[model samples]
Target: MIGDMHPGDILGEYHEEVIQLYGLGPRKVLVTEREAPYPDGRLIVSRTDTDGIITHVNRSFVEMSGYTEAELVGAPHSILRHPDMPRAAFKDLWETIEAGKIWQGYVKNLRKDGGFYWVKATVIPNVRNGEIVGYTSVRRKPDRRKVEECIPLYASMKAKEEEEVAQ
Candidate 1:
């Protein structure tokens, strides 16, 4: 909720910019340019409903994402999507998981403080009674080489997406 501000607001204007996130309905997020380094030797884990609402998160997820358990539980997993991430990456993830297959990839995630972090994410379908009910994602420190390699590729994909949108 974008709210009215009171006096002595240190973060006043720049932090308020929000966007209706993709595939996450109308939920919005503030974005920033800062990058947060992933902690070494820590793995972040989370689970989400089929519609992508967060169901569970590990302590590392909570600490790294800067979101409390109460704040994260009912939120869309896309709440953590960084704007720098190209939509095509998520599109492929969804396609792979929806087909009941595991998908592993490098990803950039957004934190509640408007900062970003990179991770190597493995998403698995939670299946029961021959049906996939939800997804569980385990994320670890992404290889620096892969993260560096993806930067320009993702930028190109984002640019192509924007070009298509402007058509």
Candidate 2:
């Protein structure tokens, strides 16, 4: 499945430098105390290759991410990863989606301007001709109650990850 999806198919017009930048840049950026306001009825969508390079994004995704179309198209999805999000959560998400399964979770995403927002996200593998070519993700404004419930769980997971890394 991974072989079926060529980087050129997902990375149209972008050069290898773009992919290298994704793998080399600062994994975490400025973190602001402010939060990005999420309005109701908005959905953010994006598509990425198996390697997680963003291929396409909807208007909502651009607006919510506080990044322009040009900025996001060639960047890794992790450009919006919030520090509060645990690495283990992403590990699980990648594992699930790579296995051709749908992965859903509450995600706290960082905006380009250093603000943050929470979303209920569902990521599905895009299979063509019996092989996965890419992935599609749909995110909507998260329920406040669910966000509250996940806060402690994610915090605990983050701590565990830190402990393991320290060991």
Candidate 3:
């Protein structure tokens, strides 16, 4: 179903609706620079439930993922998942978050066109009154050499995780 989308389709639709609703742009930005730590190169941010269902995404996230707010909301976070990414890596990420900590790593994401890009991602668990509620992620362009080194290791880990899951 995700393959059925084209780049800019989602963004275009959101632009129209937003312009119509607020005359231009959002009524108020949900995630602002004052609230976030990273302010370099348009930080991409997304919020997801514990089940990975996307709840909110910022303008940068929409622009980078090539998906509109309507399409992204309520969708699985994996909508942007790259096939080459290893399951074990995600498992580790989940473990880190579930343990009440943050997970920081590089990620390879697939665009609507099947092209891929790399990001340095920081995923944090959203907690309320000592209980985990959801997750929030901030991503930015990653260093090329770090990505290159990670790819092969991710592939091997993916293979291993798949083998283990299969059994």
Give the whole-model CA lDDT for all candidates, comma-separated.
0.81, 0.77, 0.68
**Model 3 off-target regions past 4 Å?**
1-40, 162-167
Error of 2 at 24 (Å): 4.6
TM-score of 3: 0.72
lDDT of 2: 0.77
How far out, in Å, is residue 42 in model 1? 1.3
Give me the runs in candidate 2 sitting further than 4 Å from their true place.
1-28
Candidate 2 per-residue lDDT, tens place, 27-136, comes to 42455666777878888999999889899999999988877888888777887777788877888899999999999999998776666799999999999999999999
Clashes of each: 0, 0, 0
Give the 10-residue window scoring lowest on summed lDDT in candidate 1.
1-10
Clashing pairs in 3: none
Error of 1 at 71 (Å): 0.4
Query: Highest lDDT among the candidates is held by which one?
Result: 1
